[model samples]
Target: MRSPFRRPASRSARSTGVVRVDTRTKRLTKRLQPGEIAVIDHTDLDRVAAESLVERRPAAVLNAAPSVSGRYPNLGPGILIEAGIPLIDDLGPDIMRLHDGQRVEIHDGAVSHMGKTQVIAEGTLQSAESVDAAMEEAKAGLAVQLEAFAANTMEYMRGEWDLLLNGVGMPALRTQMSGKHVLVVVRGYSYKEDLKALRPYIREYRPIIIGVDGGADAVLEEGLKLHMVVGDMDSVSDKALTSGAEIIVHGYRDGRAPGLSRVEDLGVEHSVFSATGTSEDIAMLMADEAGAEIIVALGTHATLLEFLDKGRSGMSSTFLTRLKVGGRLIDAKGVSQLYRTRISGWWLVGLALAGLLALATAIMSTPGGQAFLGLSGVLWDDIINFFRALVGLSPQSPTV
Candidate 1:
């Protein structure tokens, strides 16, 4: 009979690394190092989490919950596979029992303690093919997901109609947004690239900059200061919180603010705005209510798949918020495409020529310059006459 404890693969295929375990993938990624194994309990992991893991360059990922639950085509699994990272799916709760910094061997689908041959757990070793198949399955179920999304949107509308329509409960702000551009940054899809692309626009327009949660850190990383920091205080750094920005804490509709304590502990003054929906939704709403002439959104969700990737009913509010903001709001991704540097080599050359013409006009006003011009005119006529003689045509006398 075959051995019940048989390992999944031969010795040559085994991968060995120290495993880091965490219930929260975002927290785990902070300390996760290159070539380490990340054991996480994230269900239907989102694209941001997967990108964070890929950045850490983990040897392989072991998930306690399914990465793709087929609710909709989440972009995480395909991103990991595309980055050449190994992913082992649905390892069960037992995988979380593994201690952090515990070295382990992974062969095919089996995870074992290093230097041992016994299998500790096993899961489905994902490939490009398997991930593609899961995505297709998830795509087929999108209609159902959309129906649920619509239902959630209606529920959200009913609950937040006053806030959405009249900007009810929006707190007053010290930062003057009226008649000015506001740039709201969120640490989401292509945020870094979008931010880089917006440098020229930011420099020219000098828009009021607002950072949402960890996007505060992203803004600081780009050497920009925040005029206002909005969101739950989670995921943002102490440095960013203490950076003298106006803090607005997003609280639940019921008036409980979970992130309030963190800001309080830091001794930073802040205001609470209670509402349903994501923090980003509130950020945009606040800007619109404050009479901002234009609002530029960076790294915020804009597509159908992105809304589903959030795996929350709050995304419904985002849809409603967009409509409320209307023509004033523009996604930074689109801005990056449409915005140009405004300054060009031709403009510089024209400026230089204009300056030279002005300088020449000033010099010609001087008596010495008038004498120089007369000498130049006579020299030019002599050269023209020599040229005409060579061509057998008499040079016309200077106009009297």
Candidate 2:
């Protein structure tokens, strides 16, 4: 009588707490210190949070991940429990409607309908060991998803996403009008940090900024001006919807466009590009084809881990696509290596005061900082001297 995903009205009355899923396990482990929730698209990798139980443990994990492509074991929640972290799966559609610091309750999952709660973590959930890995994963996942997504979700991915590389297997931006550079911004992924790092470069180079749907919203949130947007229109904000950036909806081969309709509903100017690749990738191709000398990536994904999480065929597609635009493809991961935050000189002064207090307190105490007291000091020093004298004299070496 009712759709499964859309919980009926009557059920809401008895709902004790909302049940959510953990999508990005890896990110959850890296980002959540303790007492934080994990929200994301999907999960198939060993999560960092799980391994941290022996070291930097967290309180619980709230997974926003899809269970087995909409079915099956949903290993994410179970794994969290094994790692000493409570996990919940599938909070429901449109869960992002909740703000960053919003308080809410979760019920069900490995944690016996996981108790009520609130999220306390700060920043994107991803914690890649290296930028290079993140990039490979992001690019590969997008590529695979785009190829298959072309045939099935052509209408939605294209129109809303400005993604043209559908079944055709290339970024529409690569084929069409070429006039400006396209800057892509991805949130949650390590890409966001990359984007921030490359801000100076983007500003100096003056490449046209193209936000990937919600990425557009992220840039604007930071007060950065965007020239275009690409991606499925699902996650983008109302402000991005109304922003004056040029909108080109990526569509299916049949010519259906979701983003176009939404824009038309509000009577906004929009175009369509139907093909077979990700909105982010398409943005790069578009900028390159548009006659831009360089296409620098910000907050972009191109890593093995990222691809696996995308839950689609991305590895091959990303490889081929990048080959199509080799030298021009520059991933801006850790571009901010040289930019260090100025340490407050006052911070050191505070530390000096703390040291003084500890020293004074220890002097007046009976134990007198016994933890710092050395044992067998002269014996240890003599042993060290003997070792130093014999250091370079190997048993088989010639007499020196």
Candidate 3:
């Protein structure tokens, strides 16, 4: 007989059991097979992940993990269940060893295994009758934080708007950025350690660079100019505040503004946008309304972690906003069409030869040749690595 020790290439028929999906928001937003249990790991990202999960609206969203075990009022599986999808939270680790399609049974919003490898999850027990109810509670709980965010944001906004409208300072880094393709880069989940690849394009197109809140700080740290900044002002940095970009504050929908006073203290110009959604979103919307032809996205979320970090019903509005601007959205992550020139051993060799020639010429004239070569070599390496990672998604750019 053949050895029985070897395993198959993919999921075997015997282990082909369905995974139980317990969450209501993510996995349940779309159609899910009978056996697949949705895996949930809601980390501190944003709603960008919903872009992917919203497509599958599964039978149930197995909140492999939920915000505060579903105790804290938030929009996670809570919204999923309201959409008629079963939701379960805190399913524990054992649930991970499941296939995409599998059988499961849920009771009291918890897991209950039924058959061979068949698993289930106990969803959130206090099931709200409607999404509105859950959303109301979430909004109520987040009210304090939201107000603080609003106050900071509104103050920043009034200042910037005053500058832009009154032409007080002309947005420190403002240029004729009207016809450029503006890509508002954020330091969201995927953005961490991911933006290294985008520098070349940043140098190439030189679009109107706008960052949301601390995204401006990230840009400033990267040695890039920021034309404008937008957010509730809670997470932005002082460096960004003084970075010479126009700031816009996101205010509360109810007009109970909050973040404005803080902006006033900083003495920055701003405009208030009373809306619901992420600041990255506000940036995109502002760009779109202001007549940006193409809006490329970098460090945007399309995963679970980002949405959870927000812990707000803003995902609902974000969902609709994306649809409204779907055609204009382009992901620039690991993409290279915007860049020119390829880096290879041959190009490096050419650069080396050029450096030698330049050194020879400079040395012939004076003793400063070595110093010039050193400076030029450093600059060339930085430029080359930036484009290389822009094409290959390598971490080599920022290091240089």
**Best model number under TM-score:** 1
Candidate 2's residue-wise lDDT over 108-185, tens digit each? 332222243453222222211221233333444445554554544434343334322433443334223355444557
Better of 2 and 3 by TM-score: 2
Per-model TM-score on C-alpha atoms: 0.84, 0.50, 0.45
Candidates 1 and 2, the one with greater lDDT? 1
Candidate 2 structure lDDT: 0.50
1-400 per-residue lDDT for model 3 (tens digits): 2212122221111222245333333333334544355566553112333423433555445555543432234434333433444545466666665554555555555555555333443434434443334444544545555555456445545434432234332122233344578877775545534455677777666778777765677687778888887877765777787777787777765674466777889998777776545667667666666667777777665533343346654543444445555667777664444453547567899999999999688785765766676778788878878788788965453322
Worst 10 residues of 2 by lDDT: 5-14
Once superposed on the true structure, which residue ranges of model 1 sit more than 4 Å away at CA?
Answer: 1-12, 344-400
- Candidate 1's displacement at residue 207, Å, is 0.8
- Estimate the overall C-alpha local distance difference test score of candidate 1: 0.87
* Order of candidate numbers by TM-score, starting with the best: 1, 2, 3
- Model 3: per-residue Cα lDDT at residue 204: 63
